[model samples]
Target: MSTTSLTDRLGSLLMAPVHLLMRIIDIPLRAVQKAAGIGGMAAVFLAPNMLIFGIFVLLPLVINFVYSMTGGTAFFISERNFVGAEQYQRLFTCTNYLDPMSCQEDAFWTAVGNTFWFVVLQVTLMIGVSLITALILNRDLAARSFWRAVFFFPVLLSPVVVGLIWKWILQRQGLLNFGLYQFGIEPYTWLTDRNWTFIATIGVSIWAHMGLYTLILLAGLQAIPKDLYEAAEMDGTKPERVFRRITLPLLAPNLLVVVVLALIKAVQIFDEVYVLTGGGPGTSTLYLTQYIYETGFASTLRNPGLAAAASILMGLVLVVLTLIQLGVGQRSEKKGKR
Candidate 1:
């Protein structure tokens, strides 16, 4: 080799160990630098979301609590001037609190009972109907996509619009009455009868809500392995037996999600009730939410404190219901594992 070439080779050979050593040292340092960068980026991203959550959800909850403690229509006062849960007490104790319109009697406990009934009936019916619809769509039927779309389309429409459409249909001179007249039946006031009105409201709500639930359940159903069903069938299991043994167990998680969602939505139902019955003919269909709205904003006696208490109570009920669902789900999972 030439002297220059020989020198260059010798230099490279001498620096190789140094280069390797530097790389070995840099590896840990680079890892530490990357970790720090990732942590900083995560903090930056999370900080804004946390701030927004605090501003909106947490702050409002705190404000509601504070307002509940204070005896006020407009101004915030000391909790020492607090009525000491008198508002809550009155909800149970008060009787015959008449609406100014003279159209209905508004009893707090009665409204609470009505709301409970509404939630239970609506949630149960909504979930059941959705599950049935999902099962139907999940089957190997002709025009499956068409049927799925037909079922799910109602969910895309706003609840307000659904209520209005149903209202028009159930009107005295509407399609329903017109059809009934062909059978020589008189036009019945669907909205006027308390029981019928309640049923109609539930029907409208179910129509609006069932589509979303069906879609959710259908997705869950599709995720389940077909092999499981085939295995069940090969073992001489009937269709119902196969579904019970295979599908229900596998679909437990999705069922939990569906039930909880239904419960929450049913409890929070306001729009359909508002539009369909306006909580009326009487306060038969009047939900807890209607009570809150009327007390806080619409009525002659705008009791923010009372409304806040009702809201807080509603929140607590929802939290309890969710916890119960989670507990049941966890128990079911443990049982399945065993």
Candidate 2:
């Protein structure tokens, strides 16, 4: 046989099994399509994913809500007694909301306070710093790729590793203290002082996670059409005016996403802070996630029900944030159409 004939023969042999398999699959699919119609076929295709989501997401959410309504520390549902809304009541039983010490669940309230402040400060700084970094990276800088990699490198490190590295540097006997000693300054306990420890958590968290946000904003910055900037330059528009009018308006959608995501992540801050501070120095760095973890599993007087209740409350905050994001997005869309 000629070369073309040999190739065609091999191709036929290779595709024979694949064609047979397709034919086998097509029979049932066609039968189902005939039985169900187009919309039903779409639902049939989506059924597996919906089933998986129900099993993993919805089921766990239902179970968690159920657990929040029950009393006792027992891990199993059957061993626990239902005490609906009591755990939430305990959390709310405070002489003053501002004063965590007056709360029945003092630690929970303290965690809430810390989390609220942390979210406010951390999200603000995260957005600001990430925006700055992204803008700089988007410019025609020397070794631009290298600088991008440098900024994003920290994001690749595991949160545990981030905690350990910062811990070693911030510890009294660590490199930071050693450096301070070299400068003839007295070594200070950065991770122990309540104010300093809280500050350190914020700083460390920003350092650890800011890279991802920077990358996000950088992508947004790059996506803006260069033609707009060129046109503005030709019109002798000031750089600030150009940025404010063209860049900011275009980047608003990405900025909105970054803001909401950073807000959620800041509220859920845990792993690195936990490993670094252990919510210590009199619970100064204590956050909601750590409080839940400790309450559910780590505390000597473990209260899974309380933890579940707290988690549900936390989930409600997240839901509110999500709703705000949706509302803002719809408003933006309406403005865009106008």
Candidate 3:
């Protein structure tokens, strides 16, 4: 061999030990995998993702539960005194359970009251308006795609942005007020007053979120067999009768989904309301989430234990609500089957 070629060949040989070490390691892995079979392979592949979920999701939930059972301003679990259910009891303590003024944590009860109204109003209007929008869009309307995008655009905007945009327009001396002034109507306190603020938040919420739920209902509307509508048309069924007899029955599942999801969102609602009103004029818009946040993070008395307890209670209420809804849905399905 030529000297240069021989030198190059010797340099390539230096990698042999590294390659051999990898091969040695891979041999046992391959053997174990082959012996363990397909289930083992799946387990191996899934281990990383499962570990991530355990660390991020499960671990935080466990820690929150632990926090709820403890007392003190201490950050560490071991350092905090184990108070059992005292935190929960603190929340439930009241002279008159029905009256928020009688509660130890009056703010929490007030939040609960306000939230109940918000949920009732918001979910009602949301479903009603979204269903109407979906019905309109599902038809051969002019500029259909444009209108759909116009509605869906709000859903894509950040909650903060949605709040800020509405707040600006509705604020004193803002767009609405200016328009009203032009029409010779005196400017009104849109965001400052409790009643008006509640109305504003509910309206903005419906406008912002209706699109996503509209799309959901639209999908459900489309999924109804076109042939069914054609059959109804041929039979000379009135529009309202066709809708009641056919469309609504078929769309009930999506409506349920929309209602349940809207309920949950209304329960956990904070960001938009917080940005818009800061729970304001005087905690009128304060939601359970805001109450929980103030309890844990915002106040000088940062009681994580109490906040955790409140969150846990909120979670329980949601769970119960969901279970009841699911049970009803399942019962209806079984009835339909029969």
Which candidate leads in lDDT?
Answer: 2
Clashing pairs in 1: none
Candidate number that wins on TM-score, 2 or 3: 2
For candidate 1, lDDT tens digit of each residue in 1-338? 59999999999999999999999988885776587686575665577899999999999999888767656566454533576686676554433444323223234455677788888898888888988999989999999999988888888887789888998899787889999999999999998999999898888889988888898889889999888878877888998887787888777777887888888888888987798789887888888888888887788777788788788899999999889888877987787699
Which candidate do you rate higher for lDDT, 2 or 3?
2
lDDT of 2 at 110: 92
Alpha carbon lDDT of each predicted model:
0.81, 0.93, 0.91
lDDT for residue 59 in candidate 1, whole number 0-100: 93
Off by over 4 Å in 2: 1-17, 34-37, 331-338
Instruction: Report the Cα lDDT for residue 296, model 2.
Output: 93
Query: Relative to the unseen true structure, what is the C-alpha lDDT of residue 267 in candidate 1, on a scale of 0 to 100?
Result: 84
Q: What C-alpha lDDT does candidate 3 achieve relative to the native structure?
A: 0.91
Model 3 TM-score relative to the real fold: 0.87
TM-score of each predicted structure versus truth = 0.79, 0.91, 0.87
Candidate 2 scores a C-alpha RMSD against the true structure in Å of 2.3
